[model samples]
Target: MTHDLVIRGGTIVDGTGAAPYDGDVAIDGTEIVAVGNVSSNGKREIDATGHIVTPGFIDGHTHLDAQIAWDPMVTPSTQHGVTTVLLGNCGVTFAPCKPEHREKLAGMMETVEDIPKHAIMSGLSWDWDQYGDYLDYIEKSKPAVNVVGLVGHCAIRYYVMGDRAVDELASDEEIEQMAQLVDNAVKAGAIGFSTSRVEGHRIPDGRPVPGTFSSEEELCRFAEIVRDNGGGLMQTVL
Candidate 1:
Protein backbone atom coordinates (compact mmCIF):
# COMPACT_ATOMS: atom_id res chain seq x y z
CA MET A 1 0.00 0.00 0.00
CA THR A 2 1.43 3.37 -1.01
CA HIS A 3 1.06 6.55 0.95
CA ASP A 4 -0.45 9.74 -0.44
CA LEU A 5 2.36 12.05 0.74
CA VAL A 6 5.63 11.70 2.56
CA ILE A 7 7.93 14.29 4.13
CA ARG A 8 11.39 12.89 4.63
CA GLY A 9 14.42 13.75 6.72
CA GLY A 10 13.09 16.45 9.01
CA THR A 11 13.33 17.27 12.70
CA ILE A 12 9.85 16.61 13.96
CA VAL A 13 8.54 18.64 16.87
CA ASP A 14 5.30 16.92 17.71
CA GLY A 15 4.25 19.59 20.27
CA THR A 16 3.52 16.96 22.89
CA GLY A 17 6.40 18.14 25.02
CA ALA A 18 8.25 15.19 23.57
CA ALA A 19 11.85 15.46 22.49
CA PRO A 20 12.47 16.40 18.89
CA TYR A 21 13.57 13.64 16.58
CA ASP A 22 14.76 13.27 13.02
CA GLY A 23 12.18 11.28 11.13
CA ASP A 24 9.90 10.90 8.15
CA VAL A 25 6.18 11.55 8.16
CA ALA A 26 3.71 9.72 5.95
CA ILE A 27 0.28 10.95 5.09
CA ASP A 28 -2.51 9.02 3.51
CA GLY A 29 -5.36 11.19 2.46
CA THR A 30 -5.98 13.83 5.14
CA GLU A 31 -4.75 11.75 8.03
CA ILE A 32 -1.13 11.45 9.05
CA VAL A 33 -0.57 7.70 8.82
CA ALA A 34 2.92 7.21 10.12
CA VAL A 35 6.02 8.78 11.56
CA GLY A 36 9.69 7.79 11.87
CA ASN A 37 11.39 5.52 9.35
CA VAL A 38 8.77 4.67 6.80
CA SER A 39 9.68 2.07 4.24
CA SER A 40 6.76 2.70 1.94
CA ASN A 41 7.19 5.16 -0.89
CA GLY A 42 4.59 7.91 -1.31
CA LYS A 43 2.68 9.11 -4.33
CA ARG A 44 4.20 12.54 -3.53
CA GLU A 45 7.46 13.17 -1.72
CA ILE A 46 8.92 16.32 -0.13
CA ASP A 47 12.58 16.68 0.82
CA ALA A 48 12.49 18.41 4.19
CA THR A 49 16.09 17.53 4.84
CA GLY A 50 17.03 20.32 7.22
CA HIS A 51 13.62 21.63 8.17
CA ILE A 52 11.39 21.30 11.20
CA VAL A 53 7.96 19.79 10.90
CA THR A 54 5.35 20.46 13.55
CA PRO A 55 1.68 20.91 14.02
CA GLY A 56 0.32 24.30 13.06
CA PHE A 57 0.16 26.99 15.75
CA ILE A 58 -2.95 28.25 17.52
CA ASP A 59 -3.16 31.99 18.17
CA GLY A 60 -5.03 32.51 21.44
CA HIS A 61 -5.77 36.18 20.88
CA THR A 62 -6.81 37.86 17.65
CA HIS A 63 -8.99 40.68 16.37
CA LEU A 64 -9.94 39.10 13.05
CA ASP A 65 -13.65 39.63 13.66
CA ALA A 66 -13.76 42.36 10.99
CA GLN A 67 -10.88 41.38 8.76
CA ILE A 68 -12.26 37.88 8.23
CA ALA A 69 -15.28 39.44 6.60
CA TRP A 70 -13.27 40.23 3.49
CA ASP A 71 -10.15 38.14 3.69
CA PRO A 72 -10.90 34.47 4.20
CA MET A 73 -7.21 33.71 4.15
CA VAL A 74 -6.76 35.94 7.25
CA THR A 75 -3.33 36.92 6.01
CA PRO A 76 -0.03 36.85 7.94
CA SER A 77 -1.31 34.37 10.51
CA THR A 78 -1.88 31.75 7.82
CA GLN A 79 1.38 32.63 6.09
CA HIS A 80 3.18 32.01 9.37
CA GLY A 81 1.64 28.54 9.83
CA VAL A 82 -1.07 29.40 12.36
CA THR A 83 -3.81 26.89 11.74
CA THR A 84 -6.19 28.13 14.38
CA VAL A 85 -7.08 31.66 15.52
CA LEU A 86 -9.29 32.81 18.37
CA LEU A 87 -11.28 35.85 17.35
CA GLY A 88 -13.39 38.46 19.18
CA ASN A 89 -10.57 39.23 21.55
CA CYS A 90 -10.13 42.39 23.59
CA GLY A 91 -13.90 42.31 24.10
CA VAL A 92 -14.80 43.55 20.65
CA THR A 93 -16.92 41.69 18.10
CA PHE A 94 -19.63 42.14 15.53
CA ALA A 95 -22.69 40.14 16.28
CA PRO A 96 -26.02 40.14 18.02
CA CYS A 97 -26.46 43.48 16.33
CA LYS A 98 -29.58 45.19 15.12
CA PRO A 99 -29.75 46.76 11.67
CA GLU A 100 -29.90 50.20 13.26
CA HIS A 101 -26.81 49.54 15.35
CA ARG A 102 -24.56 48.23 12.61
CA GLU A 103 -22.66 51.44 12.12
CA LYS A 104 -22.25 51.94 15.86
CA LEU A 105 -20.62 48.54 16.37
CA ALA A 106 -18.50 48.90 13.25
CA GLY A 107 -17.32 52.29 14.37
CA MET A 108 -16.46 50.90 17.80
CA MET A 109 -14.38 48.15 16.24
CA GLU A 110 -12.71 50.63 13.95
CA THR A 111 -11.88 52.89 16.87
CA VAL A 112 -10.55 50.17 19.17
CA GLU A 113 -8.96 47.77 16.70
CA ASP A 114 -7.79 50.22 14.05
CA ILE A 115 -9.33 48.11 11.28
CA PRO A 116 -10.82 50.28 8.59
CA LYS A 117 -14.57 50.63 8.99
CA HIS A 118 -15.06 50.83 5.24
CA ALA A 119 -13.53 47.40 4.77
CA ILE A 120 -15.71 45.95 7.50
CA MET A 121 -18.84 47.60 6.20
CA SER A 122 -18.22 46.74 2.57
CA GLY A 123 -16.73 43.26 2.89
CA LEU A 124 -19.22 41.59 5.19
CA SER A 125 -22.71 40.59 4.17
CA TRP A 126 -24.22 41.70 7.53
CA ASP A 127 -26.76 38.91 7.41
CA TRP A 128 -26.39 37.82 11.01
CA ASP A 129 -27.99 39.08 14.20
CA GLN A 130 -26.87 36.50 16.72
CA TYR A 131 -23.69 34.78 17.79
CA GLY A 132 -24.64 31.48 16.16
CA ASP A 133 -25.63 33.22 12.95
CA TYR A 134 -22.27 34.92 12.87
CA LEU A 135 -20.60 31.52 13.27
CA ASP A 136 -22.61 30.18 10.39
CA TYR A 137 -21.51 33.11 8.25
CA ILE A 138 -17.90 32.46 9.13
CA GLU A 139 -18.28 28.78 8.35
CA LYS A 140 -19.49 29.66 4.89
CA SER A 141 -16.63 32.10 4.40
CA LYS A 142 -14.26 29.12 3.96
CA PRO A 143 -11.48 30.51 6.07
CA ALA A 144 -7.98 29.21 5.35
CA VAL A 145 -7.64 27.97 8.93
CA ASN A 146 -9.85 27.06 11.84
CA VAL A 147 -11.55 30.03 13.49
CA VAL A 148 -12.72 30.04 17.07
CA GLY A 149 -14.83 32.92 18.33
CA LEU A 150 -15.61 34.45 21.70
CA VAL A 151 -18.70 36.42 22.60
CA GLY A 152 -17.49 39.97 23.10
CA HIS A 153 -18.92 41.81 26.11
CA CYS A 154 -18.69 45.13 24.31
CA ALA A 155 -20.96 44.00 21.53
CA ILE A 156 -23.34 42.26 23.89
CA ARG A 157 -23.70 45.27 26.17
CA TYR A 158 -24.17 47.58 23.23
CA TYR A 159 -26.79 45.30 21.75
CA VAL A 160 -28.75 45.15 24.97
CA MET A 161 -28.36 48.71 26.25
CA GLY A 162 -27.65 51.01 23.30
CA ASP A 163 -25.98 54.25 24.44
CA ARG A 164 -26.34 53.46 28.10
CA ALA A 165 -23.85 50.63 27.68
CA VAL A 166 -21.06 53.15 27.58
CA ASP A 167 -21.37 54.83 30.95
CA GLU A 168 -24.09 53.56 33.27
CA LEU A 169 -23.74 50.45 35.36
CA ALA A 170 -26.01 47.63 34.26
CA SER A 171 -29.14 47.09 36.35
CA ASP A 172 -29.88 43.77 38.06
CA GLU A 173 -32.29 42.79 35.33
CA GLU A 174 -29.80 43.85 32.70
CA ILE A 175 -27.08 41.74 34.26
CA GLU A 176 -29.38 38.74 34.19
CA GLN A 177 -30.11 39.35 30.55
CA MET A 178 -26.44 39.68 29.78
CA ALA A 179 -25.71 36.46 31.59
CA GLN A 180 -28.28 34.66 29.49
CA LEU A 181 -26.76 36.09 26.34
CA VAL A 182 -23.35 34.79 27.35
CA ASP A 183 -24.82 31.39 28.09
CA ASN A 184 -26.54 31.38 24.74
CA ALA A 185 -23.32 32.32 22.99
CA VAL A 186 -21.36 29.53 24.65
CA LYS A 187 -24.03 27.05 23.67
CA ALA A 188 -24.01 28.48 20.18
CA GLY A 189 -20.39 27.36 19.82
CA ALA A 190 -18.53 30.38 21.10
CA ILE A 191 -15.30 29.16 22.63
CA GLY A 192 -15.57 31.70 25.41
CA PHE A 193 -16.48 35.24 26.44
CA SER A 194 -14.11 38.20 26.28
CA THR A 195 -13.96 41.56 28.05
CA SER A 196 -11.46 44.37 28.43
CA ARG A 197 -10.59 46.55 31.41
CA VAL A 198 -7.31 47.94 30.21
CA GLU A 199 -7.38 51.72 29.99
CA GLY A 200 -5.74 51.54 26.59
CA HIS A 201 -8.72 49.70 25.14
CA ARG A 202 -11.01 52.57 24.34
CA ILE A 203 -13.13 53.87 21.52
CA PRO A 204 -12.20 57.00 19.56
CA ASP A 205 -14.38 59.14 21.79
CA GLY A 206 -12.06 58.46 24.75
CA ARG A 207 -14.66 56.30 26.46
CA PRO A 208 -13.66 52.79 27.44
CA VAL A 209 -15.36 49.72 26.04
CA PRO A 210 -18.79 48.79 27.38
CA GLY A 211 -17.79 45.98 29.71
CA THR A 212 -14.85 47.83 31.20
CA PHE A 213 -16.77 49.04 34.21
CA SER A 214 -18.88 45.98 34.94
CA SER A 215 -19.34 45.38 38.65
CA GLU A 216 -17.92 42.26 40.26
CA GLU A 217 -21.38 40.79 40.50
CA GLU A 218 -21.89 41.13 36.78
CA LEU A 219 -18.53 39.53 36.08
CA CYS A 220 -19.19 36.69 38.47
CA ARG A 221 -22.57 36.01 36.94
CA PHE A 222 -20.93 35.60 33.57
CA ALA A 223 -18.33 33.30 35.06
CA GLU A 224 -21.03 31.19 36.64
CA ILE A 225 -22.63 30.78 33.26
CA VAL A 226 -19.34 29.62 31.78
CA ARG A 227 -18.81 27.15 34.58
CA ASP A 228 -22.31 25.80 34.26
CA ASN A 229 -21.82 25.28 30.53
CA GLY A 230 -19.36 22.44 31.08
CA GLY A 231 -16.21 24.57 30.58
CA GLY A 232 -15.08 27.59 28.58
CA LEU A 233 -12.43 30.31 28.47
CA MET A 234 -12.66 33.91 29.58
CA GLN A 235 -10.39 36.52 28.02
CA THR A 236 -9.79 39.81 29.76
CA VAL A 237 -7.40 42.46 28.49
CA LEU A 238 -6.47 43.95 31.82
Candidate 2:
Protein backbone atom coordinates (compact mmCIF):
# COMPACT_ATOMS: atom_id res chain seq x y z
CA MET A 1 0.00 0.00 0.00
CA THR A 2 1.15 3.56 -0.70
CA HIS A 3 1.08 6.15 2.10
CA ASP A 4 1.13 9.91 2.03
CA LEU A 5 4.39 10.06 3.97
CA VAL A 6 6.90 7.77 5.67
CA ILE A 7 9.62 8.32 8.20
CA ARG A 8 12.20 5.58 8.15
CA GLY A 9 14.66 4.32 10.74
CA GLY A 10 14.11 6.68 13.61
CA THR A 11 14.38 5.94 17.32
CA ILE A 12 10.74 6.02 18.33
CA VAL A 13 9.54 7.06 21.75
CA ASP A 14 5.77 6.90 21.42
CA GLY A 15 5.02 8.09 24.97
CA THR A 16 3.08 5.02 25.95
CA GLY A 17 5.53 3.74 28.55
CA ALA A 18 7.11 1.70 25.84
CA ALA A 19 10.78 1.06 25.33
CA PRO A 20 12.58 2.89 22.53
CA TYR A 21 12.91 1.16 19.20
CA ASP A 22 14.16 1.84 15.69
CA GLY A 23 11.35 1.62 13.20
CA ASP A 24 9.45 3.14 10.32
CA VAL A 25 6.26 5.15 10.54
CA ALA A 26 3.87 5.61 7.66
CA ILE A 27 1.25 8.27 7.51
CA ASP A 28 -1.79 8.77 5.32
CA GLY A 29 -2.86 12.40 5.41
CA THR A 30 -3.10 13.27 9.16
CA GLU A 31 -3.46 9.74 10.53
CA ILE A 32 -0.75 7.22 11.23
CA VAL A 33 -1.18 4.31 8.85
CA ALA A 34 1.54 1.95 10.06
CA VAL A 35 4.43 1.68 12.46
CA GLY A 36 7.32 -0.76 13.11
CA ASN A 37 8.01 -2.22 9.66
CA VAL A 38 6.46 -0.10 6.95
CA SER A 39 7.48 -1.67 3.68
CA SER A 40 5.09 0.28 1.51
CA ASN A 41 6.35 3.28 -0.43
CA GLY A 42 5.25 6.80 0.40
CA LYS A 43 4.47 9.90 -1.62
CA ARG A 44 7.09 11.60 0.50
CA GLU A 45 9.78 10.02 2.65
CA ILE A 46 12.15 11.31 5.31
CA ASP A 47 15.29 9.50 6.35
CA ALA A 48 15.15 9.70 10.11
CA THR A 49 18.55 8.13 10.52
CA GLY A 50 20.19 8.94 13.88
CA HIS A 51 17.17 11.03 14.90
CA ILE A 52 14.33 10.72 17.39
CA VAL A 53 10.66 10.73 16.55
CA THR A 54 8.23 11.19 19.41
CA PRO A 55 4.84 12.55 20.18
CA GLY A 56 4.46 16.27 20.62
CA PHE A 57 4.66 17.62 24.17
CA ILE A 58 1.69 19.05 26.07
CA ASP A 59 2.22 21.98 28.43
CA GLY A 60 -0.67 22.23 30.88
CA HIS A 61 0.28 25.67 32.16
CA THR A 62 1.26 28.61 29.97
CA HIS A 63 0.59 32.34 29.89
CA LEU A 64 0.44 32.68 26.13
CA ASP A 65 -3.01 34.24 25.95
CA ALA A 66 -1.65 37.66 25.00
CA GLN A 67 1.35 36.44 23.09
CA ILE A 68 -0.74 34.28 20.78
CA ALA A 69 -2.27 37.33 19.18
CA TRP A 70 1.05 38.67 17.99
CA ASP A 71 3.00 35.45 17.77
CA PRO A 72 0.84 32.75 16.30
CA MET A 73 3.45 30.03 16.91
CA VAL A 74 3.62 31.27 20.55
CA THR A 75 7.43 31.37 20.56
CA PRO A 76 9.68 29.43 22.97
CA SER A 77 7.01 26.89 23.90
CA THR A 78 6.73 25.75 20.29
CA GLN A 79 10.51 25.84 19.83
CA HIS A 80 10.75 23.30 22.64
CA GLY A 81 8.35 20.91 20.86
CA VAL A 82 5.07 21.61 22.65
CA THR A 83 2.09 21.23 20.32
CA THR A 84 -0.66 21.91 22.86
CA VAL A 85 -0.78 24.54 25.60
CA LEU A 86 -3.23 25.54 28.34
CA LEU A 87 -3.64 29.28 28.64
CA GLY A 88 -5.21 31.57 31.29
CA ASN A 89 -3.23 30.11 34.20
CA CYS A 90 -2.23 31.66 37.55
CA GLY A 91 -5.54 33.51 37.84
CA VAL A 92 -4.49 35.92 35.15
CA THR A 93 -6.07 36.30 31.74
CA PHE A 94 -7.23 39.01 29.38
CA ALA A 95 -10.93 38.34 29.11
CA PRO A 96 -14.11 38.95 31.02
CA CYS A 97 -12.88 42.49 30.77
CA LYS A 98 -14.87 45.63 30.20
CA PRO A 99 -13.38 48.14 27.78
CA GLU A 100 -12.34 50.39 30.64
CA HIS A 101 -10.86 47.35 32.45
CA ARG A 102 -8.38 46.23 29.76
CA GLU A 103 -5.44 48.11 31.17
CA LYS A 104 -6.06 46.71 34.63
CA LEU A 105 -5.91 43.12 33.41
CA ALA A 106 -2.80 43.78 31.33
CA GLY A 107 -1.05 45.41 34.22
CA MET A 108 -1.93 42.56 36.54
CA MET A 109 -0.53 39.96 34.12
CA GLU A 110 2.68 41.94 33.92
CA THR A 111 2.97 42.18 37.69
CA VAL A 112 2.50 38.45 38.27
CA GLU A 113 3.89 36.88 35.10
CA ASP A 114 6.40 39.51 33.88
CA ILE A 115 4.77 39.64 30.48
CA PRO A 116 5.33 43.12 29.09
CA LYS A 117 2.30 45.31 29.76
CA HIS A 118 2.79 47.38 26.63
CA ALA A 119 3.08 44.29 24.50
CA ILE A 120 -0.12 42.90 25.95
CA MET A 121 -1.92 46.18 25.53
CA SER A 122 -0.79 46.91 22.01
CA GLY A 123 -0.35 43.44 20.64
CA LEU A 124 -3.82 41.99 21.01
CA SER A 125 -6.79 43.19 19.02
CA TRP A 126 -8.85 43.42 22.26
CA ASP A 127 -11.96 42.22 20.50
CA TRP A 128 -13.52 40.00 23.15
CA ASP A 129 -14.95 40.77 26.57
CA GLN A 130 -15.69 37.26 27.81
CA TYR A 131 -13.60 34.12 28.25
CA GLY A 132 -15.41 32.26 25.49
CA ASP A 133 -15.03 35.13 23.07
CA TYR A 134 -11.38 35.28 24.00
CA LEU A 135 -11.09 31.64 23.01
CA ASP A 136 -12.84 32.41 19.77
CA TYR A 137 -10.40 35.19 19.11
CA ILE A 138 -7.52 32.82 19.75
CA GLU A 139 -8.90 30.43 17.16
CA LYS A 140 -9.40 33.24 14.70
CA SER A 141 -5.72 34.03 14.97
CA LYS A 142 -4.81 30.51 13.83
CA PRO A 143 -2.10 29.56 16.26
CA ALA A 144 0.32 26.72 15.56
CA VAL A 145 -0.48 24.98 18.82
CA ASN A 146 -3.75 23.63 20.09
CA VAL A 147 -4.96 25.90 22.87
CA VAL A 148 -7.04 25.14 25.96
CA GLY A 149 -8.13 27.87 28.34
CA LEU A 150 -9.26 28.14 31.96
CA VAL A 151 -11.45 31.03 33.04
CA GLY A 152 -9.59 33.08 35.66
CA HIS A 153 -10.87 34.47 38.94
CA CYS A 154 -8.75 37.60 38.84
CA ALA A 155 -10.53 38.80 35.73
CA ILE A 156 -13.87 37.71 37.12
CA ARG A 157 -13.34 39.50 40.39
CA TYR A 158 -12.02 42.64 38.76
CA TYR A 159 -14.87 42.70 36.30
CA VAL A 160 -17.31 42.52 39.16
CA MET A 161 -15.65 44.50 41.96
CA GLY A 162 -13.22 46.71 40.06
CA ASP A 163 -10.30 47.90 42.21
CA ARG A 164 -11.95 46.72 45.41
CA ALA A 165 -11.37 43.11 44.40
CA VAL A 166 -7.88 43.11 45.79
CA ASP A 167 -8.84 44.15 49.32
CA GLU A 168 -12.43 43.07 49.95
CA LEU A 169 -14.37 39.84 49.97
CA ALA A 170 -17.03 39.69 47.31
CA SER A 171 -20.59 40.66 48.19
CA ASP A 172 -23.24 37.94 47.82
CA GLU A 173 -24.45 39.46 44.60
CA GLU A 174 -20.92 39.80 43.22
CA ILE A 175 -20.21 36.16 43.90
CA GLU A 176 -23.35 35.14 42.09
CA GLN A 177 -22.40 37.28 39.13
CA MET A 178 -18.97 35.69 39.07
CA ALA A 179 -20.56 32.24 39.08
CA GLN A 180 -22.73 33.18 36.16
CA LEU A 181 -19.73 34.42 34.19
CA VAL A 182 -17.79 31.24 34.86
CA ASP A 183 -20.76 29.12 33.80
CA ASN A 184 -20.93 31.05 30.56
CA ALA A 185 -17.23 30.54 29.94
CA VAL A 186 -17.46 26.79 30.41
CA LYS A 187 -20.52 26.54 28.28
CA ALA A 188 -18.68 28.36 25.53
CA GLY A 189 -15.37 26.40 25.59
CA ALA A 190 -13.40 26.75 28.83
CA ILE A 191 -12.29 23.48 30.32
CA GLY A 192 -12.26 24.92 33.86
CA PHE A 193 -11.34 27.90 36.08
CA SER A 194 -8.19 29.14 37.88
CA THR A 195 -7.29 31.39 40.83
CA SER A 196 -4.34 32.28 43.04
CA ARG A 197 -4.03 32.44 46.84
CA VAL A 198 -0.26 32.63 47.20
CA GLU A 199 0.95 35.85 48.74
CA GLY A 200 3.59 36.34 46.06
CA HIS A 201 1.19 36.60 43.13
CA ARG A 202 0.10 40.21 43.44
CA ILE A 203 -0.98 42.90 41.05
CA PRO A 204 0.90 46.11 40.21
CA ASP A 205 -0.09 47.99 43.36
CA GLY A 206 1.25 45.13 45.54
CA ARG A 207 -2.23 43.96 46.42
CA PRO A 208 -2.91 40.28 46.18
CA VAL A 209 -4.87 39.15 43.15
CA PRO A 210 -8.62 39.06 43.69
CA GLY A 211 -9.06 35.44 44.71
CA THR A 212 -6.22 35.43 47.23
CA PHE A 213 -8.45 36.50 50.09
CA SER A 214 -11.49 34.47 49.17
CA SER A 215 -13.63 33.25 52.02
CA GLU A 216 -14.61 29.61 52.20
CA GLU A 217 -18.14 30.50 51.24
CA GLU A 218 -16.86 32.29 48.18
CA LEU A 219 -14.64 29.38 47.20
CA CYS A 220 -17.46 26.92 47.75
CA ARG A 221 -19.71 28.93 45.52
CA PHE A 222 -17.18 28.70 42.70
CA ALA A 223 -16.79 24.99 43.32
CA GLU A 224 -20.51 24.52 43.11
CA ILE A 225 -20.66 26.41 39.85
CA VAL A 226 -18.20 24.01 38.24
CA ARG A 227 -19.75 20.96 39.89
CA ASP A 228 -23.12 21.80 38.46
CA ASN A 229 -21.45 22.05 35.06
CA GLY A 230 -20.48 18.34 35.33
CA GLY A 231 -17.12 19.15 36.95
CA GLY A 232 -14.21 21.17 35.57
CA LEU A 233 -10.57 21.81 36.34
CA MET A 234 -10.09 24.38 39.10
CA GLN A 235 -6.49 25.63 39.04
CA THR A 236 -5.70 27.49 42.24
CA VAL A 237 -2.23 28.80 43.00
CA LEU A 238 -1.23 28.61 46.64
lDDT of 1 by residue, 112-216 (tens): 888888888888888988899999999998999999999989888988888899898999999998888898889999988889998777876888878898898
**Could you tell me how far off, in angstroms, the CA of residue 10 lies in candidate 1 after the best superposition?**
1.1
In candidate 2, what residue range of length 10 has the lowest lDDT sum?
Answer: 218-227
TM-score of 1: 0.96
Whole-model lDDT per candidate:
0.88, 0.90
Give every collision pair in model 1. none
TM-score of each: 0.96, 0.96
- Give me candidate 2's TM-score against the actual structure: 0.96
What are the root-mean-square deviations of the candidates from the true structure over C-alphas?
1.1, 1.2
True-vs-predicted CA distance for residue 28, candidate 2, Å:
1.9
Per-residue accuracy of model 2 over 1-238 as CA lDDT, tens digit each: 8899999999999999999999999999879878899999999999998999888899998988899988998899889889999998988988799998899999999999998899999998898888888988999899998899999998998888998888998889999999999989988988888989889998888888888988888888888878889998988888
- Judge candidate 2 against the unseen true structure and give its global Cα lDDT, from 0 to 1: 0.90
